[model samples]
Target: MSLCLKSITAVFLTFAGTFSAVSVAQAQGANVVTTNFNTVDEAINALGTSTYQTINTGYTETSKATFTFAVPSETLTLRYRTDNTGVALRDDTGALIARFNAGDRTASEAELMAFLRDRYAKDTEALKLKVANTPSDPVAGNPASLMSQMVSASFSNGTDVGPSPLTGGDRARGTASYNHLGISLQTGRYSGPGFSANVTSLPLSYAFALDDPRWAVKINAPLNFTTINGQDYVSGSVGVGLRMPVTENWSLTPELRVGAVRDGNSGITAVLANASLMSNYRLDLKNGYGLVFGNGLTYSKSLNSSGTSYGLSNTINKNGIELSGPFQHQLYGLPTNWQFSVVHTVVGGTPTYIDEWTDVSLSLGTIGSKNGVTWDSVRIGLTYTRANRGVEGLNINFGYEF
Candidate 1:
């Protein structure tokens, strides 16, 4: 038994040596296979129909035909696209092998493979550099928090001039007796953890008083534009308000607003709605001037089709206080109307929207006839805002109350 086992072991060793030699020779021969064809088409024809298999026709919009051939060691694939200029080759593992250009077929197979490898390396390095240089999006907070902030910025009160919320102050006197038209432009800076961005807005407004002068109607529309990580986004709102006098010095306005925000790059849309109540108290002063104090309370809600809860809550409550003083002044031997205003946010607990904000504004104007048209008032104003955990802004305003 021992002798028979020794003979079997010797036979096994000889067979293993012969098999190793044959494998090495086959690998060398595979590398020596001719790659001298001038075009990829010529190479595919050399493989012979019996040796290669067709995988598919019209594999993709760009790739029209696909075929594969096996050598002694591994498999190689060739793909033909719609255009005649080039074809792509891949290894068995689906890794890019080479891109064969029919028009410029000067490079041999080894040289072409080397060139592709170098190009791939350079392209990968370039991509890494680009990502490092590009700025990230100024995300205010989580997706929900961002959505809430956008709604608050675009649909919140004070975006436009209206009839009697007088939340800031009355427009020029006798201004309510006729139609009031105005435009406001503002640029804001928003800051949050690790990010910041600039936001711009334009608002147009119209208002009219009823025959009783105690009742009024107001309409406001505003467009807000912002860019995040080089992508553009737009938000807009439309609001309607009704003013009802509560007493001699107090008034109330109820407002309803509908708003939308769209992302230009992703084509995502968010819709929001707001309901608000605004009130004002006037302290009559001497000579057609007065000091006014007011407050506004608003509830905002938003939703998107993507099923993401983009709002902090279905109902976010916000409130703020406003003060204004309007007085008469002499400019160039004529009486001019001048006003100054200040607004501050005062909400309880952690603010879902604007945690802390303050705004100050000044305006100058006159009421008279011009260009044969009776003018109630023509005014221009400037505003500056300071805020924390929200947005700070500078504004320019124009109005024609007639």
Candidate 2:
């Protein structure tokens, strides 16, 4: 008997808790549950003995007015009208009441508000995107290697060897290898065969997508040791960039980098700035194969304060342009893509840190799925930047998507 009584009390308490929760939910809905009715009978029944006043906007005209009651009541003016002949009412040109039936389900005030707010924001953003979509017709739009158990180097003897040598930091952004989170190893040579000076960098980078896959940001701090006339010193530069997808197959990326070599023991020695833009369009080849073509442009300017540490001139300026063609394929396995590119640049003032080298690179990687969520692949590629246009650098990349 004691055990039976205990079970009975437990069940009673459970039911009581459920009922209390239901009452709370009803109170919440009481806010949005204002004046929901499927028929005149329903409305009248809901109103009970509440008094409502109707305002007139010349009933004979096409215009109609509303009837308002008090607070906590629906404010919408859904009242109907009839001709003097006592004709039947019509739903057209008037509000049609909707009745909601949750089938014994209820939500707390917080839940309802959250639901409404989320739906509103999502719908608003969707509408904005739809409106912002271009009216124009649809258009077509790196791996890492070289690392040991410890810190290793990815090198390029001479990279981007062309009419226009690009700065080691020029064209900071690259093709859309969309990854939510990524890290890459990069190496480059900024000086072109056009000049007798040589400037090189080996950088590690981190990339991350913002709230949406369509937007991403990256920050890079390249600390690779620098060699100036055989005098090697640790170099430092920090770069930041963002990428935005303008369409299903087209995107735009912008980047800015500024930093300098510190006094071997004091403070700042030299500084430079690189502002660059990269744009691309992709054409789908179906079955995990596609084509991407792109262009990159950058302006690099620098000031050398170290004077003699490196041969860098007092001032340097260079403009560069790159054209790219990337092939998308399944590689029948983990290799996701292959790319080829060419660059040209024009140099004005000779800045020791700036170079006019043409560059070419090829990469392979893939974005796959594991448990419904997407996972980006490890990308690895080889690049050649030389005064004579030969492979001089190598890059490795790893990324994740959520």
Candidate 3:
């Protein structure tokens, strides 16, 4: 029994050695079979009437057919072809698997084959999952069937004029505004999958007063200035947004907005338009610990009339990143839900300046105090999101989502 086992082992070793030597020789001469077909179609036609051709051994001759060959039994099969003239690997299925054509240079067949083999061996399951979870359109979850509108009135007091230097000391000359009356209306739509959109508008009116008689005297002496102590500024904005689920707990949203400022005294107006893209992720925490976080980016531009070119030429660009997470009621019985966010804005193009005494003027072809300015604030508030109500426009008011 020992002698028989030894003879079998020796035979196996000899066969393995011969197979390895043949493989090495084939590997060294594989380039002799290279082709110049740019595409699978060209290669298939060049193969002529031969249904199959043998190239590398062990790989069946029937499996070596060009892309265009018809295999009645197998409905699907993967084919590989290379264009020795260029650095592209053209798959039998017409897909350009890889390209090494970097302008004027061409890659050798061996280099191209190595690249194709590496890519084919990579793990693609994660990439497939990511693509499958991405949404192609907007989706608003849950359907709220209520509609309502809200009107809010507020009072604000501030000064439009700044203090100037007096003979003996610096004094706040000019005027101050007080008891401003402002009204806002929020209209909501509650229908279709748990989705709601709100429209808000605000108009303000104020009373103005002048201070420091000396500063007024100096201005009127040099230039015949008529002090219009009071002025009105009206600002309005409209926004529309919708959210839809791409997966079980992930959603995407797109929003568009337009804002305008009209001076009641000069009847001049400035307009700004913005667009935003946002995504929300829902995290499953324990009861009363569920959190939803989101982030978004915005692009805005300003516009003004041609004749009255405010020195800044009405050019402004801004981009911001924000993050907000909502936590449920846990230890504290506080029914308040909290969210926080920070936004950094980059300002570009021309600056704007408004003189309290004279007409508004454009300066530096850019608008704002600094070329780039960032304004970030955080707030926490409670949320009352209800579903299936029959009002016209009332929904929810919360901070911006990142």
Candidate 4:
């Protein structure tokens, strides 16, 4: 059914008492199809019969059915309920355009038409603004950046010089051999504008002397569970390092790691690789106090990161100082070892990375012989970090070595 332009103008004039400037300026160009409807089905059928193309039709629930129609410049939608009170028009982004009720007469057809046109114009302007404001580079807040953050946290944090062959290897004879096995659990959460990441990892490590007291091979395997933007994923890594003692007090290790994260639903994998050189120096202080100074340089890169739709690459440097000493009093009839460590990241990571964080850790634990072995230790620690890009995190870590 169609309403005449003269009738629409008359109805507006009667209710408004005077034809305002806006009404006068826009009434002439108002689309008559925006006129009031007796029922919502009438509105939906109207668009279906016009230039709008029907995109889909579906029911949200038993009582509500929705129809969506689109054109090149606009998208229109209508939802019809069993009660016929759900007639509403919406833009593509689900912004409400208009709500219609059966036999409504409070507003004139011209007024309804004017409101529809104004809403459409506003929606168009908003779409343009959103497109202009969206970041063109995915690194700012994309999945790739989230994965990069995970990789950085795994490599940079949770690792320590505690009881490692590079730190306190026994040197009785060239044929002296030792074995180290340990596990570490770490979790971190980071957030920034438009995105966030949460990750938990369990890593197992094993080190053994390579037929020489001062030479060792270390292997690390980690299993990771991560969530980014509300989606969950599983990933893991394998790393290997070789220790070469420079002197009685210093050692160096060169390491390589490979990892992958998979999009479980899509079966796409993002691959990562990192190489690092680590140095450790030990000082035996007087009065049972011990000091360990550690430094590391690393390079990391990504492949098959199209799964995240961005590239990941970074260089990082780490320096840490740690002091450990025996407690003056025994705990539970066992001697306690207390440790404090502070690590600083000298170089930052890529965009959206939490690389340049300073970390502080403190712990108290017991060290004693296990079975016939003379060296065994177990510790629980807490770490706090403030990172680049305003990221902050706290973590609980546990370690055991024999």
Winning candidate number (TM-score): 4
Scored by lDDT, model 4 comes in at 0.51
TM-score-wise, the better of 1 and 2 is 1
Candidates by lDDT, descending order: 4, 1, 2, 3
**Model 1 lDDT per residue over 70-150, tens place:** 332345565555534355678888999778774622233334444433433223222122212222221122111233343
Relative to the true structure, how large is the alpha-carbon lDDT of every model? 0.45, 0.32, 0.25, 0.51
Residue lDDT tens for model 3, 122-236: 2122111111221110110111100000001100001011110000100011111111111212222322232234333222222212253111111100000011112233444
- Per-residue lDDT of 1-402 in model 4, one digit per residue for the tens? 332321222111001111111111112344421233222222322442122211111212222345454322455655544534435667778998777664432232234444544443323222222212221111222222323433343333223443221112321112125676667676766566644667677767777877665788767777777776676777777878777888887777788877776656444465767787877677878776778787877776655454232244567677788887877766546566777888776443443223356777776666433335534556677777666556665666666656
For model 2, the stretches where C-alpha displacement exceeds 4 angstroms are: 1-179, 186-202, 263-268, 303-335, 349-355, 367-374, 388-402
Candidate 1 ranges with C-alpha deviation above 4 Å:
1-169, 172-175, 188-193, 228-230, 304-309, 314-334, 346-354, 367-375, 389-392
The runs of at least 3 residues in candidate 4 whose Cα sits more than 4 Å from the true structure, single-residue gaps closed, are 1-176, 191-196, 265-267, 305-310, 328-334, 346-353, 368-375
Error of 1 at 253 (Å): 0.6
Per-residue lDDT of model 2, residues 253-287, tens digit only: 67666655443532335455556565545565645
